[model samples]
Target chain A: MSFDIALWLVQDGVTNGAIYALLALAMLLVFAVTRVIFVPQGEFISYAALSLALLQAGRLPGVVYVLVGGGLVAAALDIALALREKAPARLPRIVALYVLVPCVMAALAWWAAPRSVGLPLQVLIVLGLVVPLGPILYRVAYQPLASASVLVLFIISMAAHYALTGLGLVFFGGEGLRSEAFSDARFKLAVLDITAQSLWVVGASFVLMFALRLFFEKTFYGKALRATAVNRIGARLVGIPAELSGSLSFLLAAFIGAVSGILISPITTIYYDTGFLIGLKGFVGAIVGGMGSYPLAVAGSIGIGLLEAFSSFWASAFKETIVFTIIIPVLLWRSLRSRHIEDEEE
Target chain B: MKHRLFTALALAGSMAAGSAYAEITIGVSLGSTGPGASLGIHYKNAYQLMPKTLGGEPVKYIIIDDASDPTNAAKNARKLVSEDKVDALMGSNGVPSAIQMAQVAAEAKTPMMVLTPAILSPAVAHWSFIVPQTTELMMGAIAEQMKAKGIKTVGYIGFSDTWGDLVLKATEFHAQAAGYKVVTNERYARADTSVTGQVLKIIAANPDAVIVGGSGTGGALPHVALVEKGYKKPIYHNHGTVNAEFIKVGGKAVEGAVAVTGPLIVPEELAANFPTKAMSLDFTRRYEASFGAGSRNGFAGYAYDGYLLLNAAVPEALKKAKPGTPEFREALRGALENVKNLVGTHGVYNMSAANHNGLDERARVPVQVQNGTWKLMK
Candidate 1:
């Protein structure tokens, strides 16, 4: 490739890398906190983009219903738990958090969805519709099986992914939808021209990553989540609520996924099942990063994105196979270097 | 014991009557949901326009949703044969699904009309009948057009599956014959959200024209990417872009692009003496009458042709053997194989024992995207 063409490919790679990096960070965060790999992370991303597309088209999105439906189910679970524990005080908080908040959000969204509003409101509507779904899903599926084996949790995660994919089809029809670009302006970079959307995707992902770092390093809730990740039983004994950490981690992952969806939606069409493949790419990054380290995952994800771009340039037919193939050597290297540990008897 | 005897007598009587006046059930397993639904919906709507009675027998259509899954398509085909007792099978969409159903048709010794383009050899063509023009016909048109336009070099981008392989192979064959050099080849998954890397590589190669081999809304991505990247070369697409959703999703990016599709997509633009004009317009009139104005696409034409093929062949099969029997199905298959000069929505079919598709140049017509609508280019 010529120098200018190579430069353009790098820009494309970096743009995709930014999105993958955000997903990788989310995967790392969830795995670290919950000890469960969140597989439906990309579905939230797709839902975010699809919700915005609906909002922009002056139609109320189906995600509002998903949110309320999830909220109602989670509220029922909380109410049942409260009754069993004889903790009447927990019922009011659960009602306010799950029932009242989601209902109000849904009502407000319905009012605003039909209006020909600007892009900012449209984006917020998408985020509002997508972010809360993570925790609600956690409450409905993961919370009940908290003490299960990792393999069991993994299976449940896969089931939830399939369920979410089906629901994605129902919520957003089979036709792929692309949103209007946040910005379409292009700037000349020496020999190559780069669109403002690429810059926005890269800038937004990094900003979100920095914000996440601040949350984990500086905030009390973040530290509690970290502690829970470090030692689940010890943290529970020391008054760190494990469930709160789990929910918070999913909430953060949802935010990351939703933002990435919005960023990438303009560049390409978003479909119901699109997120699964994208999330799988991010999972590769997570594995390369040892599945827990944030910075390593970020770096690994960017490398993957670049490798994918180059591979597509070189042999487009085998690009996916090439990208996925990177994990094999990394996995082998890890397995060969590390000793296998036996699980304790239940 | 008396009740059992009466039930047996009733079943025997019904069986005798069924042979005399058969209810010919045609089972359709289509992708009514998932990504294939856009085209599948059109086929489903077109099937509604079929006459209830054909060949002096009540025709029953048992349509099921395959969800674009090949496994489901095979299962649905098996169910239609064994449980529903359908005499013939037709599928609504996707090549992989059609290929799977073709295997079921062969095993059950039933005739199957496939609505999508698939690579069927003479062996597979024994049981399967392709409705859409093969990839070779469309790519040949594109290559001829490119050569006529004095385009010397081209770039290729397509799905990374059998669909892609077929299109690529077709392009390579035709382009080479036209003495055109293929500068670059790119592939991506159907659900991919970006084609920047592929588009960039294609641009770097700097060919005179680009041909994208993808279906439905997903096909529009590369066009958008090309436009955004400021590549001004002519763009050509496969027959898969004949649907309304491609135009809707593509918008300005797809404008000025050339495509090859069934004549039914732009019947009004066809010449008065075109072989498919009279029948294609008939289909358009009936389809729009029910589905509303301008509701027809090439996908609907494939399904309509499937119905027409059966309508002609079933009556001839009835002359040979009675319906609701294995002899009748074998006769139907035989009749379908020998169909000659039967005009349908897409083309004039002349099915021989060897050629199941039975369509020549009449089945395909060149078209261009103009002012957000398909305009006949030929």
Candidate 2:
């Protein structure tokens, strides 16, 4: 309507879009490196937010238990396989990462939860409790099905999403939680008032994105991950261990998800199942990018956020439908532009 | 081995006594683990605090979790009626799920005490009696307050579900009589994280005040957005939004937010002469004691009132036939239709052939969020 109102809407859209962009990048990274859709990526966001909320309240978060449980399961699976293959050397690494790390994190949470640790420590502890869940989930649910078709992997991803959502409910309870804002600063930009929390979201998102770019460009492990994404078997033949690439990608995705959760929790109320819809919106942005290009996916996610903001203003009731509908035309255009190719597995 | 034999003997003795005096079973289906779990869990908790007997008869409550899905609620209702042979049914915190249970109750000719206010079809209405106050009755309190404050226009934002539609219709219905215009009718999904776009549109219209039609923690989103955007006008909420979780989620932004909810939430603020004041106080004391302080909610009160309604009608139904019989169910339905001046935690219910939710203006009280708690607005 008014110029000032339009400007406010744009600010809101961009702030939300920033978070979605982070999620899109994670989805893209996981999908490329592992051939898994990573449907449970949003669960990590909810887990982190709820975990942080609990930490702030000086209560031990249920995510500590999930981390430990997932880690033990992964360790057991790894041990069973190692023994079967007579690869006893692999046992120590599995024990360290799967058994020791989660146990240490859980111990840290148990000790610090009741001390009313300051917000910074709480956030660090939350990151410690939630980040490892990514690799654990990859090892437990995805690695075994590494060579499975995309459809099968997608199905497994959905199952993981449901399982995590249920566990979130059991852990977080039914009430939605909103954490304290990172900052209380508010400034007027023209006629629009900008919240410091939004600035934090946008700033942090860009930093993570730039950091990801740097990592992919400058690091040897990043190059290996890139090679695996380009061709898993070829990278394996060239001595890039597929499992290492998969786990590394998942670790990065989990870190991004946790950071996004911490940034956005102050701006909006997040329930146990809230991440699924947010993740789906990110998937929409990924689809718009043809699920391949990083820069396009970021642009597409920001566009989605802007579109959602405007659509809600125009037709609030049909906002979600309007947002999800964009994927159809984008899919059509991509299908028309790209040449047909044989199935990769075939 | 000796303990097992003694337990078997005690069970056999109780089974013999059970054959002599039939047990009254009430099947309850609630959304204890899904989107509506926040409210449903409270309803479930109320059952734990309820009396063990109904109208001098030993009663059994079979509680089932429907996961907040309407289809599952209907299935639970059917199973309870057929397999458990429940004489009557009670359920469900969400309106959609409650309506599904009402359908099964109507089909099976079993009397049901729905925990949520639902606008049932005439056939379903015959078998289902609503426990909570109707939307019209609850929203009318807001309209009265608006008119008294001389507010001329209001913006509306609510969930895009049956509850939202009902609240909007009620707001509009009262707007005509209250002499105010409703400028907007925006809706958001229950699981939505933000309402910035909707709040911006409402701000552009810039009504004198705003009313949110959402329930549970979801209701806090629009109110928080409105406050963050510097809308200083008062924000009103329906009965559904008046809970500790709403205040907890909305935080300081909802400091001046107002809502009309059951008098059960603020029992101490009710006048001593109020009909349900004593019952409300007692229920609040026991509820908070069991669930911990500041956990008092209106949803749980609805469940307790449902039990009260059934407690009052079961005696009359028992005079006609034995428990676990279809004839007894018909009698219970008949008795429920004639219940009068029965006091419960929320209000004194007076069910009739036409009005199932028999609450009046006395059932609601205006409350404002002050210092992060709901205080009665005198």
How close is each model in CA RMSD to the real structure? 3.9, 1.7
Q: Which residue pairs clash in candidate 2?
A: none
Cα lDDT of model 1 by residue, B1-378, tens digit: 999999999999987886567789899999977668767778888878888876668888899999888999999999999998888999959889999998888889888998988876666678888877878977888988998989999999999987788888899988778879887878988787677779988887889999998887878999988988899989999988776667767878889989998888888888999998989988898888997776667888889889888998999999988766788889999999888998999888999887888889888888999999889985
lDDT of 1 at B130: 84
What is the clash count for each candidate, in the order shown? Answer: 0, 0
Please report the interface RMSD of model 1 to 1 decimal.
1.7
Once fitted onto the true fold, the runs of candidate 2 whose alpha carbons sit more than 4 angstroms away are A342-346, B12-20
Best model per lDDT: 2
TM-score of chain B of 1: 0.92
Query: Using TM-score as the measure, which candidate wins?
Result: 2
Over B1-378, each residue of candidate 2 has an lDDT whose tens digit, in order, gives: 999999999999988887588789999999988888878889999999988899899999999999999999999999999999999999998899999999999999999998888889998899999999989999999999999989999999999989999999999999989999999999998777678989989988989999999998889999988988889998999988888989888888989888998888999988889888999999999999999998999999999999999999999999999999999999999999899999888888888998988888789899999999999999
- In terms of docking quality, model 2 is medium
Q: Write the per-residue lDDT of candidate 1 for residues A167-270, one digit (tens) a residue.
A: 88777777777787888698987987878998999999888889888987999998998898777888889998878988998898888899998888888888
TM-score of 1: 0.92
